[model samples]
Target: MSSDASSPLAEPAPAAGGGGRLVLGCTPIGNPGDASPRLLAALAGADVVAAEDTRRLHRLCAALGVTPAGRVTSYHEHNEDTRTADLVAAVQAGHTVLLVTDAGMPSVSDPGYRLVRACGEAGLAVTALPGPSAVLTALALSGLPSDRFAFEGFAPRKPGERARAFAGLADERRTLVFFESPHRTAATLQAMAEGFGAERPAAVCRELTKTYEEVVRAPLGELAAWAAEREVRGEVCLVVAGAPAATGGDADPAALVREVLLRVEDGERLKDAAAAVAQRSGVAKRELYDLAVRRRAE
Candidate 1:
């Protein structure tokens, strides 16, 4: 493939009467080979290329053997607010504006949402060139339930916020996915163990698609210990098994009472804890609340 800016893959100019459109290009998370052909064409042909990092965009282009013919500008968190209007204006002027982030799709825990929303509100056409995603990759590699899951993005950085977030999801039945910095992986895993339960099955996926890609599968407690024992490196994704299905009327009353007490010990109000546990176990919330109160007294 020619690295020339005028490569044949570049699309021809839009028709005279056609209004311009906003194209979201999904970049490779790790390996450059993951770049889609559509992404390459968009980079070469778009009139304005808005990138999270122009240098990284050039690096990707270099690796893909292509040169962007368009004008490239930085469009990241810091500049997103200021740049949205200009980018939208470019599109309105009948110029194709391509948005690319450092990795993965733009607007996913990255810059681009504001621009997209602005464009949408202006009645401009918006489209995406979907490609690599760490969320799907990690979930598939997790060997856990993929049929249904929730993407929690990144866990809260503050200790109290993180605890409350995890506690709120304790009874979530769908599998959960999370992203965390390499430095905080151990600490986050420890918190997950504390909030989700020590024996909850989970996977720690890091450096996905790169040379050192590693996915550690084990109980949350074990993963926490593993992270603590070594220096974790690279971007990390966490996939955790959700709460087990409620056993309905067959559930052990004693076990349910114990579960309620655990939540109370974690600082949840007795009534709130009982209601949450009751909903998960298919028990009457009022009965569960009374039983928990009596158990506390005992």
Candidate 2:
């Protein structure tokens, strides 16, 4: 059951003694204007403000022009494990503990999961003031299918591991999103090209909502080539179209392979041509791609 959108927000019945609860607030991903009014109230009212970076929390407060009337403390990955118990105890002791990350919601590829779990297990009251998110922001901006999507946070750093990971998702039918750094963006894109097929449609979103925001939509191979040519910078959100649905039709394998090869000869990359034909003819993409490449070499 969900609340009606038109209904006024109802305040939850406070834990015994009128307080002792955990509040997870989302900071702005990039822009300060996205901060919600409830978030502003939480920032100024919570008894204890636990931030991924206390300095950044201060910066955000400065930008929002609201000073927190609480004890500011650090709660990041390195200290989350050690500090979880204390934060939980604070909530139990009638303290309003607000957990915030540097940007976006905590525990989504960030800290706060352990504390949230601990608080939940202790049967303490916990809530969130939702705001901005990079995953949804990038997905909406990518112009890709949004109904179904998967967020693969930060592609594996190692080459072999990353390749295997991408290979595992090669046949996925839902759109895929990944977080990547500027320096590794080119290499990661190239690897995705090889694993998911060269022509798979994708978009590289950079510095979302920031002053120099940029989004480049193209095939995986072309994006890879573009990244390789220059130094890609800023935060990167890579969104790739999923593999086409398998039709399970009785399309002749030989005929499909020939069709793929014809497109290849018509100047399309072999993988791209194979994927396009596979989607339409219900042929196995990798099989058709392999056959086309082999025939082309011959």
Candidate 3:
């Protein structure tokens, strides 16, 4: 907080306007104790609450000892697109609409993005009540490099496609974070191991900031096996180490050339097959393609 004489914090509060406002409130990602006092006041004072799930919002409000002063309209995945104009209209009409989601900040892999964008387009003041974020939480706990990181959301759902996607990131030097579903986590880890190699260190953070939260640090292969038999629950975020720079002593280039030729032999298209081989072997596609042509000609 700046100590200037005319600082905004020191300015007298303005009266609630008749035809303007929206509050993009941030709720606790997990623990109720994580809720900031500003969030509590926002919920209690807003004229309308547009939440991802009204029941969940109610539960949160109950835990915080806040009985909302106005109605809560559902603003979620199924209806956010259609509901944006109406919600924006309410704000234009002077209703202070409060937005929240199941976890973390809404609009981040959540539904409030559209509404927030709409409000911005319509010249309404937009601000956040910043609070807990799982992405930051998981990264801090993962024991991976955090000075620079990439959030890729989630991996592709298909098995082979997912592997190819991971393979593309095999050269990324920055730590990578991702969101994963409970059911698909095992397959995700397996694909990651295949891409980054089973030896790459990674962490699986589950139910972050909650009572049952867990963080497992191990090689991707070990995590994959650990996930196979368990009924993993809650939201999961994974932190994966970026690919290590190659030294002089990796697998022989002749063996890699042989592998590329084999994929082509198995009815994979020259173009598609070349990409997959390039991903797996960390060899440039052009180099592999030249070797591929030479092998085929012979």
State which candidate has the highest TM-score: 1
* Deviating ranges (above 4 Å) for candidate 2: 1-17, 247-298
Model 1 regions lying over 4 Å from their true place? 1-18, 248-298
Lowest-scoring 10 consecutive residues by lDDT in candidate 1? 1-10
**TM-scores, one per candidate:** 0.83, 0.79, 0.81
Give the Cα lDDT of each candidate. Answer: 0.86, 0.83, 0.79
Q: Which candidate, 1 or 2, would have the higher TM-score against the true structure?
A: 1
Q: Tell me how far the alpha carbon of residue 155 in candidate 2 is from the true structure, in angstroms, after superposition.
A: 0.4
lDDT of 2 by residue, 79-165 (tens): 776678877888877788889998889999899889999999999999999989999999999999999999999999998778767
Among residues 3 or more apart in sequence or in different chains, the pairs in candidate 3 whose N, CA or C atoms overlap within 3 Å are none
Candidate 3 per-residue lDDT, tens place, 1-298, comes to 0111111111122227665677888889889999999999988777767788878888888899888766667777877667788778777776777788988898888888888889999998667899999999999999998999999988999876676567567668889999999999998998887677788999999999888999999999999888987887899999998767653247445555655555565567887777876776577878778877887889
Error of 3 at 67 (Å): 0.7
Q: Residue 65 in model 3: shift from native, Å? A: 1.0
